[model samples]
Target: MDGIIVVNKPKGMTSHDVVNVLRHKLKQKKIGHTGTLDPEASGVLLILAGKACKALQFLKDTDKTYQTSIEFGYITDSDDIFGNKIEVKEINYDFDFEKVLQSFIGPQKQKVPMASAKKINGKKLMEYQREGISNIDVYNEIEIYSISVLSKENYSFEVHCSSGTYIRSICRDFGYKTNNLCCMKELVRTKVGRFTLDMAQNLDEIEIDTVKLYPLSYLLDHIERIDYEPVLDIYNGKHVRIQTNANQVCIYDKEKPIAIYQRDHFDVFKSIRGLW
Candidate 1:
């Protein structure tokens, strides 16, 4: 029960709902999910149960890819098809979607969606919405790594972005950027770093012993491993020295990760996470 399982989350269930369902089904506590998927969205949801929960930080550092469709003739108050309509415009069939999509390839600033999980004044933005509060003072500096047009008729596209980027905001921005009333119609997260839809299982599909593995295994290409005695020193909360050309590195005791070490501006090793 102490590993990560990919759940192809069903629509209309909050990420917390998935955790509660799995908790009831498996009868194990201490379960956590890497990222929150909107209730209307369905796709890869990484569940970290038991010791795998410790790897949450490692998984959050990776990128996410989603396949989403946008409707261009109408906008909703919630920015998706499920919300109340706020605007409408005639669809423009001649617009250059490719070039418009290309314009958003790099870094950008986005306002946190009103219905998002971001908190303000001790309440989530969504909570604020229910209480008739609508002002937010936060914005996110996010990068859209890549975007490709999947289908022109329905405005389906695949986007790979940094973990915290909001796909709903992208849809909202695209509508205004094009002077159209746009709303997200459908969304499916295809991947979260190495975890993909193909690796996901239903609640009935979990095989406890067979599905769990050390999450740090996904970062092997970017990290150098340590095999010496400092593994125990760091585990015991003692400072230890290690060498690495990378800024952050993971120390391992044979096949198990012991700690994540980082350099002080790439100069000295400092343990960041202790797995022991």
Candidate 2:
């Protein structure tokens, strides 16, 4: 129970709801998710139960990939189809879809939608929406690593992006770039860092005994590992000198992660968190 559970979260349940359900089923009090998946979206959600919750802070910067469909013709108050219609336009089917998608392949600022969990002034945007306060403008830096069109006929595409990049905003921006209104129709997070949908267990079908909890080494496989003898320095959160090109590394002993280390100086590494 002290490891990662890759849950294929169903649509209509908030990420918190999944945690609550698993907590009840597993009877584990300390449980958390790596990232928040919109209630309307479904797919891979990494659930950390017990000691695995400690890895949450370090995992936030990991990149994610999503498969999403866009509907062109009109947009809603929310960036997705669940909101009130705010604008309508004819679909520009003749536009160069490939070129437009490629244009979004680099770093750019995205407008945060009103109907989102993103907070402004300590209040979630969604909370603001419920109170009839709609005049808020928020933007954040995002990068689209790659975008592969699944089917242009249906405006379906897969995007790999930075952790905080909103796929809904991408759909909205894509429509505006093509001179048509558009909204996200459907979304499924296919990947988060090294975790994938193929590794996910269906929430409804998963059982306590059937659940697969990945070890810390597997859960944090993306991080560079340095196998060394167990020492008091690592356990006491002390800095150790280790040669590595990576900005962060996991110190391992007998193939098990003992502590996560970050560079303090040139060769000196400071314990950021002890995985043990």
Candidate 3:
């Protein structure tokens, strides 16, 4: 119960709903999720159980991949098909789609949708939208690592992007670039960091005896690791002397991770977080 659980979240169920179900099944109170997926969207949802909940901050910067469908010729209030229709326009299927997809590659500023759960001034943006206050426009830096077309006929494509990149916003922008109104028709998170859909299980399939909890080390696979000599120093959360060029590294004791250490200054390393 001190590791990660990958859940294949079903559409129409909120992210919290999935967590609640697993909490009851496992009888574990410290369970939490790595990130939230809209109830309308489905796919890989990482559940951090027991002590694994503390690893949340470490995983937040991991990139994510999604398979999404974009519907053209109509726009919605929420930037998705489930929202109320706000505008309609003629479809321009003849546009150069591949060129447009390539244009989105690399870094850019993306406006966060008002219908999203992003907080502003201590209140969630969606809550503001519910109260008829929709003037807030917030933007954040995001990068699209890659985008590959799956089916032009269905407007389905897969995108690999930096964490926090909103596929709905991408669909909306795609429509603007193509001169057609558009919205995200469907979305499925295929991957988060090293975890993928192939590793996830449907909520009903997660029985306590059969459910798998990936070790905490799997969460830090993207980070570098070093076997240092000072074991007690690492355990005590003290700065340890080391000589490595990595900005941050996992201090390991044999097969187990003792703690994650960030370079303090020169060759010294300080505890970012202890695994124990």
Candidate 4:
């Protein structure tokens, strides 16, 4: 029960809905999702169960990848097709694909989606926007690693972007450059760090009775590993010293993770979590 489940979230169900279902089905109360996906989006959603929830903060910073469809000539209030239509225009661009791709290359401040979980003054920004509040400061600088137009159908195109970089916002910018409105037609997260959609199971296809769950260690493969026994003195709450070439590593006893150890200035190890 203490591991991660990469759920291929079906469209129309909120991320919270998936968590709630798993909580009931798995009969575990300590379940949490690493990141939130829009109801219209479907793909890799990391669900942490039991004590695995404690490691969420560490995993939150991982990069994400998505294959998205952007439709031109129509804009919506939510930036995606799920929202109310705001405007429509004719697609009349002899688009310079290179310039379009270059526009997203450097650093740019992206306006956070009004329907996102960003907060303002201790209240969610989306709630404030719903109440007619429009002067909120919810913008953040998101770096776009790369953007390649997979296919162009008139003005609609398929693209892939890095984590925190909103595909809808990219469409909006594209529209701004071409004098036509644009909106996201669809989205599917392909990967979150090392986890990919290919390795995920759709909600409807999930056989709870025979589901194969990956151990939490699979997700922590990037972290260095430390053997047990030498840290027995610190397993029960006291910090132990150890020699290492790295600053931090995941300490394990046999095959069970004991805790994450951090190296001191003098090369001593200290537990960060685990050892309950």
Candidate 5:
């Protein structure tokens, strides 16, 4: 109950809905999700349970990956298929698939989705937009790590992109090249940092008894491991000096992680998180 559960979130349910369901199913409070996935997207939702909730702040900058489809020949205010069609035009010219992919290269400023959870003037941007307000400006810098145009069928193409980048906005920008309509038809988050879709659990297929939970040590793989007798004394709210070449170490009580320590300026190991 104190570990992370990577759920393959289904489309149409808000991220909050997933937290609510898990809270009920797991019968534990203090639950939270790593990032917000739009209701239209599905896959790789990292849910923290119990004491694991404290680790959510550490995952905010984790990179994300998604496989998405873009439909050309129409544009919408919300950038996705759920929004009202704002423009439509026939696809008559030859589609330069390579050029379209290259347009998204490097860093770019993308307007946050209107229906996003981003706040503007202390209110959610979507809330203000609902009341016919448009003066608020909200944009974020996102890098397109890589893009591959899988296929082109008539006026649609499948694409993959890095996290913090919006597929719908990319589609809208792609449409601008030919003044055609474009929107995201489908989306699936395939990866989140080290976690992949292969390890995700589907809602209907979730089994509490068979649930696989990764220990905190799995996430701290980059940190060094320390095994010392006096380390336990320091880890137990007492300070002790032990000579070790490792600058950082994961103190383990047998197989379970008890605490993570980093060398201080005075060459003392300090606890990052104490396990209790």
Candidate 6:
């Protein structure tokens, strides 16, 4: 009951709604999600059950990938089709989508949608919008690793980006760059770090008490593994120094991971998270 559960989220249910359902069925009080998916969007939603909630800090920085459809012709206040229609336009001419997609492949400052949960002065931006607030200036620096069209007929495309990147906002920006109004018609988060859609299971398919819990080492796919000699020190919350080729690695004792360590100083390995 204390590990990660990958849920293939269904559209129309907010991420919190899924968590509440699992919490009731699993009978575990402590349940949390790695990130959230909009009510209109669906895909991989990782639920941390019981003690696994502590793993959020470790996984929060992981990158994400999404397969989304950008519907051109009209724009909404929320940047998605669910919001109040603010503008409407017709496609007068063909536009270059590939070139515009490539231009977003680096660091850029993106404005937060008023429909988003991002807070301003301890209040959600959406809350401000509800209070008749307009044009609240807020921005987040995000990095887009890559983006490409998956199918033009379906207006489907894929994007790999940093943790907090908003696909809805990207759809809004794409239309602005192309001189046409656009909004996200659908969104599906296909991947979160090593967790992909293929590895996800539907919510109805899980039995909280009987579901197999993935080991903490599952998140260490990107780090190198090293066999270290200090088993007692690490278990006793002690730092162990070891020379490793990688800047960060999973330290193991007898093939069991003790902790994820990073080279903090000159040859000094510090424990980032305890796996055991």
lDDT of 5 by residue, 24-50 (tens): 877878888888888988998988777
Give the per-residue lDDT of model 4 (tens digit) for 9-34.
99999999999988888788998898
Full-model lDDT for every candidate: 0.78, 0.87, 0.89, 0.74, 0.73, 0.82
Clashing pairs in 4: none
Q: Show where candidate 6 strays beyond 4 Å.
A: 209-212, 221-230, 239-256, 260-276
Error of 2 at 124 (Å): 1.1
Cα RMSD to the true fold for all candidates: 2.8, 2.4, 2.1, 2.2, 2.9, 2.8
Q: How does residue 93 of candidate 6 score in lDDT?
A: 46
By the lDDT metric, which is better: model 4 or model 5? 4
What TM-score would each prediction reach against the true structure? 0.86, 0.89, 0.91, 0.90, 0.85, 0.85
Model 2 ranges off by over 4 Å = 222-224, 227-230, 237-249, 262-270
lDDT order, best first, reads 3, 2, 6, 1, 4, 5
Q: Residue 135 of model 5: what lDDT?
A: 62
Q: Output the worst ten-in-a-row residue range by lDDT, candidate 1.
A: 212-221
Give lDDT tens digits, candidate 3, residues 1-276.
789998999999999999999999999999988889999999999999986777677774379999999988898889999999989999887687778888999999999998998999999889999999988989989999999999877988999999879999999999999888999999999998888999999999998998989988888777887887768877888888887888999888887776889988998888888777
Model 1: per-residue lDDT, tens digit, 26-62? 7778887887999989998888777667766765446
Candidate 2's residue-wise lDDT over 157-253, tens digit each?
9999997799999999998887889999999999988889999999988788899998866667779988755477788887788877998998877
| lDDT assessment of candidate 2 | 0.87
Q: Count the backbone clashes (under 3 Å) in each candidate.
A: 0, 0, 0, 0, 3, 0
Model 6: what TM-score? 0.85
CA lDDT of 186 in candidate 5? Answer: 81
Count steric clashes of candidate 6: 0
Worst 10 residues of 4 by lDDT: 153-162
What order do you get sorting by TM-score, best first? 3, 4, 2, 1, 6, 5
How well does candidate 1 score on lDDT at residue 219?
A: 38
